[model samples]
Every structure is written in C-alpha cells, then in structure tokens.
Target: MLEFKTTSPEETFAFGQCLAKVLSAGQVVCLVGDLGAGKTLLVQGMAAGLDIQDAINSPTFTILNVYEASFPVYHFDLYRLEDAAELYDIGFYEYTEGDGLSIIEWPDKFPDQLPDEYLWIEINSDFVNNGGKVNERVIRISALGTAYEHICEELKQICPFLP
Candidate 1:
C-alpha cells in the first residue's frame, strides 16, 4: 500500500495525470472516494496524460464513458448500481476484461463482480483540529496483480508526494 497527500483538486488531478503516464492496456484502477473527493478530477488528469483530446467527465448517469487516447480509457461510474447483477446486466465483465485502461468509481456497489487484477485507489479527507478550515486529502493505493504492482511503483516515481 502507498499513501500520498494532495492539498487541492488540481493536485489530485495532477496525481492522476502522473499515474496515466504509466498506464497501459489491461489496467484496472478502482477509485474509492466520497462524492466530491476529486475522483473524476484524477481521471481527467489521467486522460490528459494519455493524450486524450476530448474532455473527460464523470459518467454517473451513463455508467460508463470511453475515450480515445494513447491507450483507450474506459471510465465507469457504478454509484447508481444496486448489485453485481446490475453490473453484469450492463456487461461490466466485458469492460474489465477488455483491452483498455479501466477506471471505476463506486466499485463497492459491485465488489463481487470486480476482477482480482485491479488496483484499489482509496481517497479520504482529514480535518485539522487546530486549524481554521483546512483539510488534508489522503490517497491510498493497493495493487493486487503483479502488473499493477509494477505500474504502481512507476506511478510513485511520477507522483512526488507518494509515501
């Protein structure tokens, strides 16, 4: 596991962009965060690093969004899903096994449906007890597969704040 801190949304996105530099086909990144915790921002940065020309946005309603880039990026937002069955109904398995970089948000909704070859990225916010409205964002990364472990090490070198 690796932990890093981001002071702002842009930093979060920058982190994503940095991670994107090392991404390739057959990569699955599971993003676990609060609603406004900058998960999408990180993905947008990843897209930028991947040379995705078009804008990248959250696919909460659409469930999935695909972008053309140096390598394909398949973004999925499963926030609305109630069960793994719903995900299966939408061909979630196919997406995970496809030849592209898969980035998923709200993966907890379909835990059983997720492949064992994914990297879990968890983001949490911490409040400063002695400060006046200041917060620290913690980003934790856990890689399950050998490929992901190597990719994550590469990503850490790119992200200066990685711990």
Candidate 2:
C-alpha cells in the first residue's frame, strides 16, 4: 500500500499523472472517494499523462467516456449505477477485460463487479473544511496483483519528487 497527502487539486492531479504514465492497456483502476474527493481531478492528470489531449470530465451522465492516447482509455462513473448488474448490462466487462485502460469512479457502489486483479485507490478529505473548502486530502493506493505492483513501482519512478 502507498499513502500520500495533497493540499491542493494540482498536487492531487500531479500524483495521478505520475501513476498514469505507468498505465497501459488491459489495466483496471478502481477509484473510491466521496463526492468531492478530487477523483475527477486525478483522472484529469491520468489522462494528461496518457497523452490524451482532449478534455477529461466526469462521465456521470454518460456513464463511460472513451479516449484514445498512448493506449485506449475507458473512464467509467458508477455513481449513477443502481447495482453491479447495471454495470454488466452496460458492457463494463468488455472495457475491464479489453485491450484498454479502465478507470472507474465510485467503485464502492459495485464492489462485486470490480475486477479482482485491478488496482484500488481510495481518496479521503482530511479535517480542513470551511464552507466546503478542503485544505488536505489523503490518497491510498493498493496493488492487488503482480501487474499492479509493477505499475506502482513504475509510477514511483515516474515522479522523482514523489515519496
């Protein structure tokens, strides 16, 4: 497990970009966080690292957004999903198992549907709330398989400033 703290959205996105640089096809990353935990910002950094020049936004309404970069990237938002069954119905398995990188938001809503071998990331806001302004955040990353461990190590190297 890797733990880190960020004080701003830019730092959070930079951390995500570091990880994104190491991502490739057939990789699934589940992001667990609350409503304003910077999940989308992290995804933005990941997309930037992947060399995706297009805009990266939360696919809350569309459910999934596909982008082409160094490799295919499939971004999914499960916040609107009623259950894991809806994920299957939307052909989420195709993305998770296909030749593309899959990044999912609100994965807690579909724990059983999540891939067992996928990487997990949890983001939480620390005590710094004044009218909904977060001053600190905690991000926990866990590697669930050998492939994910390799990716984590690669991400570690992607940013020399990262600890």
Candidate 3:
C-alpha cells in the first residue's frame, strides 16, 4: 500500500490529478471513504487531469455518471444501493468490463461484486484531532493487479507526498 497525507482539499485533488497520469482504459478505481472524506474531490481532480469539461459531482442520486475525456470516465456511487444485485440495473458489470475507466464510490457496499483486480483507495480524516478541519485526509492506495502495481510505483515517483 502507498500512503499520503493531504493538508487541504486541493492537495487531495492534486493527488488525484497525479494518479490520473498513470491510469488507462478499462481500469477500475474503488474509493472507500467516509462522508465528506474527499473521495469526490479526488475524482474531480482526475476529471481535470482527463480534460473533462463538465462539472464533476457525486453520482449519489443518479447511480452513475459518464464524462467525456481522453477515454470515458464511468463514475458510480453505490451508497444508495440496497444490494449488490442492484448493480445490474445500472450496467455496472458492463462498464467495469468495457473500454473506459471506472470510478466507484462506496465500494464496500458490494465488495464481493468487484472485479478481482482494481485500484482500491481508502481515505480517512482526522477532523476531531485537526480541530475539525474537514479537509485533512490520509489516503491509502493499493494495487490488486500487476499493472496497477507498476503504476503505484510510478505514482510514488511523481507524487512527492507519498510515503
């Protein structure tokens, strides 16, 4: 696992921008975080890196949102899902196996349904200890595939804050 500490929301987003530099088609990124833990912030930065023009927002109510970029970004928010089977209703499997990049939020809701190999990111905050600064976050990135393993190494080089 690779770990990073972001003192502000911008830093967290910057991390995502950096991460996007290493991403490619048919890749899946699973974001696990608490409410307001900067998961969407990171994705927005990724949107910027991918040159997505539209505003990036959490797909909480919509289940999924697709954005234009070098390759399509299939963003999904599974927080509202009642069960893993509901994934089919939103074409989750198709997107995951398709030729686009997939970004999933609240993946813990259906851990078993996720592909065997994907990027898993965990973001946690220390608001209580940081005087309630909502932006303080520690992000952990892990690779479950051979390609992602190499990508993580590349990320460590470009991301100065990764430790």
The lDDT for every candidate, in the order shown, is 0.85, 0.86, 0.92
Which of the two, 2 or 3, has more lDDT?
A: 3
Ranking of predictions according to TM-score: 3, 2, 1
- Please report the TM-score between candidate 2 and the true structure: 0.92
- Runs in model 1 with CA error above 4 Å? 127-135
Off by over 4 Å in 2: 127-131, 160-163
Pairs clashing within candidate 1: none
Q: Look at candidate 1 and tell me the lDDT of residue 45.
A: 84
Q: Write the per-residue lDDT of candidate 2 for residues 84-161, one digit (tens) a residue.
A: 778767789988999999999998887777787988999987655577777777888899999999977876666643
Candidate 2 residue pairs in backbone clash: none
Clashes of each: 0, 0, 0
CA RMSD per model (angstroms): 2.4, 1.7, 1.4
